[model samples]
Target: MATLRGSLGEANLGRLVVLREAAGLVTDLVGSEQPVFAWLVHALGSPIVMGGQAQRTLYVADADLVPVGEVPEVRLRMIIEAQNETDFDAALAEAAAIIDVKQIDDKELASLLEKAAEQAFLAHSLALVATPVALREMGFRSMAGSEEALQFKRAHAGVELRIDATADWLANWRLTGISHSARHAQYSEKLLPNEVARGKVFLAVLQIWREAFGNAGMPECLELAVLYERHQASMNRIHVRRPVLTVDPKVFRAILRWMQEQEHKLLDPQGDVTLAFSDGLLRLATGNVAYGCAAWGDWVDDCVVVRQDLLALSGPLARARQIRIEQAADHLGINGLVLHRSPHSIVP
Candidate 1:
C-alpha cells in the first residue's frame, strides 16, 4: 500500500519532484524538508499498482484471475501508450503496472480483474464459514469474519473431526473474500468498518496471487489476530473437557425433528439459540441450564439423545410461556443433566 501510494494519487506531484531531485534533475531544492524521494520513486515505479476508479486507489495484480483477453499483448500495448510521455521511466512504470493489472484496453483487462475477483471472492467466503465454526467451538465470537484470528474454542477429544469439502473450501474462499472485501471497504462506512476490513479484502487478492506466483508478502490479518487475542501461550496449550452426547443417539433424531417442525414456536424463547462446542456435543447455556445438543456420533447410533441435558429447562410449566426456555428445549430434545433451583429452603 505504501509502495504504490504516490504515482497515481494526489501525491504524484510531490512524488515526481522527489524523483527528479533523486535523479539530480532538480537543483533548487537543496534545503528540502523531506527525504521521501528515493522511496517515492521506487513506490511509484513498482509494477504492482494501477490507478483505480477512485483517485487514491491503487489496483494491484491478481494471480488467481486470468486475463479475459490477450494479456501479454495488452502488456506490450500498455508500454507503448505510456512510452511517449516526457518521463519515459515513469511511463515504463505505469506501463508495467498496466501489464500487471492485465488491464489497459477494452474487454481484456476488465475481464481478467473480474474473473480473478470472483475467485478471490470464493476463497474469502470459504474462509468465513470455516472460521466461525472453529471460533464457536472455542467459546469465542467475532464481530465479523477475520483472517488473522487464531483464537478457537477450547479444544477437547470428544468432537468429531469430519471435514466437509464444502466447509474447507468455504474457509479458504472466505479468506479470499475478506481480502477482496477490504478493497471495497472505503466505499461505505458500514462496509469497511475499520482498516482491518480493507486489509482482509486486499489480502485475499494477495493469497490468490500467491497460489500462482511464488510467495510474496504475507497478509497483515494474521498479525492483527495474534495481537488481539493476547494469547499467553501457543495454540497447543488450550484445553477443554469433552462431552458424552452419543451414549444414545436416537434422541438426537427426535430433537432434530422437533426443531425443524417447531422452528418459530420453539426457538423464540432462546436468545438466538447460541451454541458452544465441546467436541461431541454443543452446549446451549442460558442463565441456569446448559442444554447439550447431540449429533449422532456414528451411523449405527440410531438411539440419538441430544447429549441428555434438557430436564432442567422442560416440562409443562417451562413450555407455558409464549416465549419460554422449555419451548426451545422441546426442539433440542437432548437428554442430559440439569442444575435446578430449590423449591423449599429454610434459611436462618
Candidate 2:
C-alpha cells in the first residue's frame, strides 16, 4: 500500500526496465545453485539514491511488482513477471490503443500519456518494494531524530530564543525558534548556533536603544532607526516615520561604534552626546566621535561592543540526552536504512 512518485527520465526509465527484466531472471534462479541469483540479490540490495541531495533509498520487498510515480514525457506501465498472467498489461495497452485511434485533442492525449507515466512510475516503485532482498539487507542500526535533541531557551530583553542541539558538533546545533514582543516585527529565519550567538550583539544594540528611548517613545533620527532595522527591532512595527537609509557596511560599523560610545557617555550626566548624519558625514554631539568618509575602512582597534566574557556568562543550553536508535528506525519505517551509528554525538 506504500505509494511513491518521482520524475523518471529516459535513463532512469531504461534502468527500471532492465531491472525489471533482471528480476524475472533472478527469481527463476533463486532455488538453483547458480551464483547469478546471489549476485542479483546483492545488486538489488545495493542502495540507489532516488532524488538529488534530498534522496531516498530504493528498496525491494518481494519479486512480484515494482512501484512508480510521475515522469516527464512518456509514461510507461511495465510488468516483469515470468508467469502467464498479463491482465494489467493488456488493459493498459487497450486503453492506450483506443485513445490513439480516436480524434482526441492534444490536451486529451497528453492527459492519457501523463496517466500512463504515473502508473509506470507507480509500478516502478512497487516493484522495488515487492523485491525480497531489499528488506533482508536493511539490518538494524542507530539513528537520531528531533526528539533526541537537547532543547533550551534564553531571554534577552523581550526576545525569547530557543535552541536545539543534537550533538557536540557546532553544525549539529541550531536556533530553532524565537518569541519576541508582538508589537515588534517578527522574522522567519533558520540560524546556525554560531549565528544565534552573533545575534546577541544585535540584541544588545536594541537593548541600548530601548533603554535610551524607553518603551513609550521611538527614536526620531534615521541613523538610530536604521540601527533598529539592522537589529530586527524595526521601528516600522509601530508606524514610526523614518527615512530609508542605506549606507556602506563600513559606515554602519562606524555608526555602531558611535552608538556604543554614546551608551558610555549617557552614563555620565555631564557628557554631551549628539548624533547626526549629513552629506556622508556622521558626528556625535559631544564631538568625541566623527566619520567624514563614506567608507570608514578597518578599525584602528577592535571595536568589541559585547565582550566575550559576558557572552560566555549566557552559558550552554540543556544537555543532550541519549535515546535508543531503534526509535529512529521505527519513525522512518521502510523509507530509510539505518547504518552502524549516526555520525553525531553530544558532549554532555
Per-candidate Cα RMSD to the true structure, in Å, reads: 22.7, 26.8
| Residue-wise C-alpha lDDT for candidate 1, range 1-348, written one tens digit per residue | 122233234544232111100111111111234311121122223233233321111222121122223225455445435533435576568767978786467567668668876656444333221222322322323333643332212111222111111123212313221111222221101111111222243333333334423244433333323322233233336753232234223343344345444545543333233334445564544333345655333221112123223332344223332311111221322333232222222111
In candidate 2, what are the lDDT values of residues 206-246, reduced to their tens digit?
A: 34435433343322322333333443444346674322223
Backbone steric clashes in candidate 2, count: 27
In candidate 2 the C-alpha lDDT for residue 190 amounts to 31
TM-score of each: 0.19, 0.17
Report every candidate's CA lDDT.
Answer: 0.31, 0.32
Which segments of model 2 are wrong by more than 4 Å? Answer: 1-107, 110-246, 267-348
- Best candidate, lDDT: 2
